[model samples]
Target: SQQGEEDPQALSIQEGENATMNCSYKTSINNLQWYRQNSGRGLVHLILIRSNEREKHSGRLRVTLDTSKKSSSLLITASRAADTASYFCATYNTDKLIFGTGTRLQVFP
Candidate 1:
């Protein structure tokens, strides 16, 4: 299975603080991508880090991949209320993607 599991089903943080989430997958993947969803809307791609990459950064977001452990983590620095959303980690195969349940992040002002 290409399923990825994310910890802390939910998280609550104050504005300007940082939030971190972790994910673990079962099978091998070509790449892993992070996505964000506001409310019940569609997911928006955040970042894509290949299997060979150890770490990647996009603006305030930083991602680390550990192929040995088959896991990854995402960190959002200096977050804001606008960052309140559901974050998901998706494992990509040749044909499709398998998404984690997601971590619902609530940023309070």
Candidate 2:
């Protein structure tokens, strides 16, 4: 499948801890993007890594992409209860945009 697949569909963590999610895709991609959805809210773009980029960071978020392995990972450090949400990875190949299932993260206070 061209769509990405996320590991450990669910995660529970305490505030100030860290959370990590992995995504693996079938085919080559132009870029990979991570997104977060808070309960019933719309998806918020987290980060994007291009084919030439190996890693990227934004605030408390870190993203890594391995084109050779067709996989990517997202890490959120010093997580908070407000971080409780669902994370998703989307891959862009040429004109197609495919998204993974998602990882549900619950951060408790």
Candidate 3:
């Protein structure tokens, strides 16, 4: 499948702590994107890293891509309770976006 799968289907962290999640896919992709979805809300784009790039960072989030392994990882630093949400990794195909089942993160104060 072109879609990816993330580990730790769920994670819980205390406020001010860091959280990391890993994703693995089966096929190559032009680009990979990470998104956040608040409970019952639409997804909000967090960051996107191109296949040619090895790593990228945005605000408190860090993303790494390994094309050879068709895998990626996301790290959220100093997480806040407000950051509690479901995170998904999506790969860009020709005309559609393929997303993983998603990792549910809960940040507790």
List TM-scores for all candidates, in order.
0.95, 0.94, 0.95
The 0-to-1 C-alpha lDDT of every candidate, in the order given, reads 0.94, 0.91, 0.92
> What is the alpha-carbon lDDT of model 1 when measured against the actual structure?
0.94
18-46, model 1: which lDDT tens digit per residue? Answer: 99999999888889999999997999999
> What TM-score does structure 1 among the candidates reach?
0.95
Candidates, ranked, lDDT: 1, 3, 2
Which sections of candidate 2 miss by over 4 Å? none
Per-residue error (Å), model 3, residue 3:
0.7
Q: Which runs in model 1 stand beyond 4 Å of their true positions?
A: none
* Whole-model alpha-carbon lDDT for candidate 3: 0.92
- Candidate 3 structure quality by residue, lDDT tens digits, 49-101: 99999999999999999999899999999999999999999997678898988
Top model number, lDDT: 1
> Where in model 3 is the C-alpha error above 4 Å?
none
Q: How far off is residue 72 in model 3, in Å?
A: 0.5
